[model samples]
Target: MSRAAGLSRRQFLALGWFPWLRPRHIGLAGARFRILRNGRSLRRYLRIHGNEETARQVLERHMETHEGIAFVIESRTRVVAVESLQLDPNRMFSRVGAEANLKLLNPGVAPERVRRALDLLDRGREKLVRALTPPRGGMTIALHNNSSAYSVTAEVPISDQTSLREPGNPHAFFLCTDPRDFETLKTSPYNVVLQQHGPKQDDGSLSRLAAARAFRYVNLEVAAGQTERQREMLNWLEWFLP
Candidate 1:
C-alpha cells in the first residue's frame, strides 16, 4: 500500500463487526478532568470526551491495572458546561478550536460572555495540558470510542500512512503522531495510522498538540461497545510502544 503498512484492501465499509466495549472532577469554571494514577511512568493516558462511554470504561479498567496516569473528564455527556456555556473538552486545548466550538455551541451567547469564556478556558487549558503532556521519551496515549458513522475512512484522507489489519473491524484502529512509533505499531497485527505532520488548522485535539510539541501521541479509537477489542488493542500498544 504505497509507503504504508501492508494492509489488504477492504471495501472501506462502515465499521460493523467490532467487539463492543471513569472519573469525577466537579467544576464549571473550565474543562475539568479527574486524575487516575496507577503507579508512575512516563506514559500518560487520556479520555477527554465524557459521552464516549466505551472509552471511559476502557480507561477506567486499564488504569486500575496499568502503569500510567489517566485523565478523564467528569461529565457523562459529550458537551461539558463551563461558565454556563457548552464546550467540548477535547476542543478546549487550543484558542482557535476552543473559540470556534464555543461560538458554535452557544450561538446565542453574548459577545462579552464569549470573550470571558475563552479567557477562562485559556487559563484552565494551560494547567491541564501541562499535566497531560508526556515527558520526553514517554508516550501520551488516548482512548476514544466511535460509532459506525465515524470509521477509519473518515481519517484515511488526512493520514500519513495506514495499516488496516482487521478485515471485519474497520473501527478498531490506532492513530499515532510520531513516525518512529508508527513504524513499531505498523508491525503489529492490528490496524494503525501514522499522522506525524500537524494539520494547517489546529482542531485543539490532543494529537495536534502532540505533533506540534514533537512528542509521541497515540490514540486507540475503538467501536463504541467493544471493550474486549479495545483493551486488546490498548494492551498491544502499551507492550510495543514502550
Candidate 2:
C-alpha cells in the first residue's frame, strides 16, 4: 500500500483497460473466494453468493474503476461441497449456522462429523474475518441478487426503521446495520432499511457478525439479471456516501 509500490495514474488507468491484476483465490475450509483489489479505500465490497451473477458482475466492474477490495465467492452455484455435505458459504460465518447448514439436507450425517467440520471452519474463519473487517473509519458493503419472492418487504418485518423511497422496486434496496448509515441512506432515492440490532437467532450471516462486532455493514440487493441497474446504484452509493 505504500506509494513506492503503488501504481501510477497511467498504470491505474491501464489496469482498467487491461486488468493487470488477475483476481487471486483465497480458500477457507472447503470454500474459496476470489479477491480483487485496486488502489485503496477504507471500505470493502463483497459478493457473498456465487449464483448472484448480477451482483458479481456489477462488483467486478466497480473494482475496475474504484478503490478498495472486493471478495467474491468462487463457485457459480449457490452452495459448495464441504466434507461430502453441501454448505451455504454465507452461513459459514458462525459455528451454529454452519452446523445447521451442513445438516440441513444431510440429516443422516453424523453429529461427530459435523463437529470436526466446524472445528476446521473456526480456524479458517479467523483469518477470513480479519481480512474482511473494515478499518476504524469505514464500512463493509455486500452486494446480492434476490428473486422477486424476496424483497425489502420481507426485510421490513425485522428492520428497526425503513425508508421505502423506491416502493415499486422492492428488489433493489439497501439494508444497513448502523443507524447513522441508515439515516444517511434514507435520504437517497432508493429504498433502505436499518436492522440496527442483531437478530434474535444469529443465522451466521456476515451482517449478523458485523452487527455483533458493531462494525458498519450494508447490503445492496438487486433483482437478478439487472446488471446495469445494479451498477448505477453502486455508482450512486459510492458517489453519495463518499
Candidate 3:
C-alpha cells in the first residue's frame, strides 16, 4: 500500500494483461502517475514539480470532495520521465517545448538519442494531452507553488491582461488563459493575469496549448505551503467560473 515505488515497469505491464486493472489505475508514461476520474468535467494536475507540496495538498484535498479528474504525479521532484534527464513535466505538452526540455535536461546529449526520445515522447504526449484536456467546456486547473524569487513582475512582460493588487504578494497569483475568465478573476481579491494571446516565445507549457485550443485553463499559483490561501482561491473559482 506504500505509494513509493509501487510497481516496476515490468510489473505494471504484467498487471495490465488482467482485465481488472483498468486504465485509470494503470500508470502512463513509464508509470509516472495515475488518473482519478470522478464523474465531473473538471480536470486537475498536481506535483508536476516535485517540490510544490502546497499546490499538491490543495489539489488533493479539493479532488477528494469534488467530482473531477486529477492526475497526481508520483514523484517528489520536478523531473518525472527519465529522472536523469532532468526534464520538467509541465514542458512536455508541445513539440517545441519537448525538444527544448530534452536539450535542456540533457546538455551535450547525442543528437541520435534526442531524436529517439522525441519520437517516443511525441506518441506519449498525444495521449497525455488528451487525458489532461477536460470534457467540452470544462476547465483544466493546474496548481503551482512559487518561492520568493518568482513573482508577478516576471510574468507581466508576457501577460496580455493583468490585475495586480497594490502591494499584493507577488508570489501568490493566478495565470489564466481566457479573456472572460480574466475579467471575472480581476474582480476577485487575488492577483490574476490573462495570457489568452500568445507571447512572442512559447516555452511549451500546458497553458500555451490550452490557449491555442480555446480551452478554459486556470493556474492557481501561490507561495509554497499556503494551503489555506490556495484552497480559498480554488473555492472562489468554482463559484465564480461556474
Candidate 4:
C-alpha cells in the first residue's frame, strides 16, 4: 500500500507537523518544535517593526498558516515567541558546563579524543566537588559597566559543615564585549577559564565568568563603557589561560 494509504488514523495524526497533535509524542517533539515556531514568529515580528497594527495583523495571518504558535511576550524589548509543545523530563536538554560544550568545538578533532579528554576533566571536577565536600559554594562575579569594579556573590550548598571554605584555587574567565576585547582577552596574563568568548550579552556575562573562572582569575570587558586603549589592555590579560 502507498505510505499515506497504509497509515492508520493515529499514525496519520502522528505524522502531521503540529506539535500538540500527539500527547504521547510530546517528549520527543516539544522543544524543537517550539524553537522553530518561536524563531519564525520572532523573525516575522522583527520584520514589521514600527507598524504595530500591521504587525499584529501579520502575526495573526502567519499563525493561521501554522498551528501551535505561542508568543512569550515578556516585554517590549525582550519578547520570545514559542509554540505549545511540552517536553518530557527525560528528554530535556543537558545541564553540563562550558567545559563539556568546549569539547564539541574544533572541527577536525576526533570525537573519541574529545570524549576521552572530557571524561578526564569530568573526573577531575568530580574530585574537586568531593574535596570541597559539604557546604560547598558557588560564586558569581559581575563586572561593572566599564572594567572598573567587579561584584562577587558567593553561596554555599547547605550541609553538616558549619563553614564553607572558598575554592582555594584562583580561576578567571574572560568576557570580551567587542572584537577588540576578544582579541585582548585572548592574549592576557589571566588564565583563560572558558575556551569560548563573547559575541555574548548581559545575561550570559555571569555564566561566562563562572565557567571561565574554573581556575582563579577571569578577564571581563563591559561593552557599555569600553575605550580603544582599554580594549588593548584586555588583550594583555590572555597569558594566564592554560
Candidate 5:
C-alpha cells in the first residue's frame, strides 16, 4: 500500500490495529499536525481551517496547563490535506467527502489525479481517525471561528435537539454529536445542538465521522477574532464534559 505523509508503510499498518499509541504527532494523507500530549483524556483540534486564528489561540492557551492531546495544523493558511489541492482538511475524513471536496476545489483537475488523491486519503483516514479519537471514550472537541452570517439556526434543521439561549447569540454556539453530552451542555450559557443523527447530506466534516463512529464530538464555534469567547467555551467544555 502507498504511504501517507510522514507515515511509513509500517506505521500505517501498525496504526490500523493499534490506536492506543500516544505519539506527539499525527499524519494525514500528505499533511501533518503537531500534537501536544498532556496526559488528559480530552482530545482537541484547532485550525483545521487555516484562517481560524482565534481557535488556534484558544488551543494554545488551553495547552499551558491542561492534560490532553491537542492537534494543531502546522500552517496558518492552508486547511486542506495538500495545500496545492485546496481541499478542506476537515472535509477529507471520508471517501465521499474527499471526492466532493476535491471536485469542489479542483474542478478542472484530471480524473486520474483525483482518483490517486482520493486513494491516499482513504488509506490515511483510519490512522488519523484513531489518533484523533481518545482511547477511553473521551470527548473530542474542535474549536472554530466563524463569520457573523453563520449561526445555530443554520444547523438546527439537521440537529436532533437544540438548546438555544434566550435571545440567542448567533456569533457563538456548540455543535455536539453525543446525546448525553448535548443534554448536559444545553444548560450551559452557550447555545447547544445535538446532531446525533446523520444528516441527509454528508459534508465529510470531522463531526460527521465522529458521529458515524459514535464518538463524543463537540465543536466550539465563535465569531472570528473572538479569542476570549472561544477560550471560555473550551474551558467550560473541559469542566463540563467527560
Candidate 6:
C-alpha cells in the first residue's frame, strides 16, 4: 500500500469501529473521514468532486447553483480528477471548532467591523501610555504585568476593560499581551485554546478545545522586540485565518 493508503488505514483503526465510519454514509465511495463527536471518532465521508478542478467547478457551481452557500476552499494537495461529491456543510463547520464559537459571540456582525475595532484599539496604544502617566486615581496601563516606565498627562484613564470583555459581543475585539494570556482568558461554555510562543500544537488547537471543551481561546502572541520572535509570531498567525 502507498503511504497515503497506510495512513488512511491507521486513521480508520484509530476511529475504533463506529457506525458513522462507513464511507457510503458520508457521501464518499472509498475515502473515509472521521471526527470526534462526544469523545468518540465518528466516521463520515466527504463528497469531494474528484480532482481539484472538478472540486473547484463543483464548489463554484454549488454557490452559484444554490443561494447563500458561502465557502472558502483551500487545498494543500493538488486536485487532479473528480473523485467524489458529498460535501457536508455541518462537517465543515465542525472542523472550524472554537473559531466558530468566537464568530458566534456576535451574530450578524461583518468581518470588517471586527477588523476596524481591532484597529481602533491598536491606535489607543499611544493614548494608553499617555493615560497611564503618573498614577492618577489608580488608573494605569501595565505591560504583561509591569507598570509602564513613561508617564503622560491625559485626562482619560486607561483600563484593561477597553480591550477585553466578558459576554463579549461577536463583533467586539478581545486583546491579550501574549497567547498564554489569551489561553488563560477562556472560560466555561466555550471551547478555544490560545497558546503562547511555541510550535503549533499537533492536534489543531480548536479540536483539542472541542474535545476537552471550554470557551473559545484566541491565541495572540505579543510581538517581542527581537526580529526573529516577531517573524515567528507573524508566521504562526498567517497559518491561522482571522
Which candidate number has the best TM-score?
Answer: 2
What is candidate 1's lDDT per residue for 109-207, written digit by digit as tens?
Answer: 898888888888877676678888898789889999998798777777788898887757778888899999889988988888888884588887778
Give the Cα lDDT of each candidate.
0.80, 0.85, 0.77, 0.29, 0.79, 0.27
* Residue pairs with backbone atoms closer than 3 Å in model 3 (clashes): none
Clashing pairs in 2: none
Per-candidate clash tally = 7, 0, 0, 25, 1, 21
Report how far off residue 21 is in candidate 2 (Å): 11
* Candidate 6 lDDT, 95-181, residue by residue in tens: 243224324444565766545433443344233223112222221111110013311111013212222232232211222223443
Off-target runs (Cα >4 Å) in candidate 4 are: 1-100, 127-139, 142-221, 224-242
What candidate 5 gets wrong by more than 4 Å, as runs, is 1-23, 42-46, 81-83, 166-168
Per-residue lDDT of model 5, residues 161-199, tens digit only: 988883457769999999999888987888988999859
Q: Indicate which candidate wins on lDDT.
A: 2
RMSD of each: 15.0, 6.0, 6.6, 19.4, 5.3, 21.2
* Every model's TM-score: 0.84, 0.87, 0.85, 0.21, 0.85, 0.17
- Candidate 4: tens digits of C-alpha lDDT, residues 1-242: 38868889898867756654422211111111111142222111111111123223333444455332222121222111112221121111222432233333334556565555445434443332221121222211112222223311111121111111222312223432233333444454432223233223212222333333442223332323343322333334422222
**What is the Cα-based lDDT of residue 224 in candidate 1?**
89
Clashing pairs in 5: 40-67
For candidate 4, give the lDDT of residue 222. 30
The predicted structure with the larger lDDT, 4 or 6, is: 4
User: lDDT by residue for model 2 over 96-163, one digit each (tens)?
Assistant: 98988889857889898888888888888988898788998788999999996899999898888999
Candidate 6: where is the Cα deviation over 4 Å? 1-216, 221-230, 234-242
Clashes of 1: 7
Candidate 1 yields a Cα-based lDDT of 0.80
In model 3, what lDDT does residue 118 have?
65
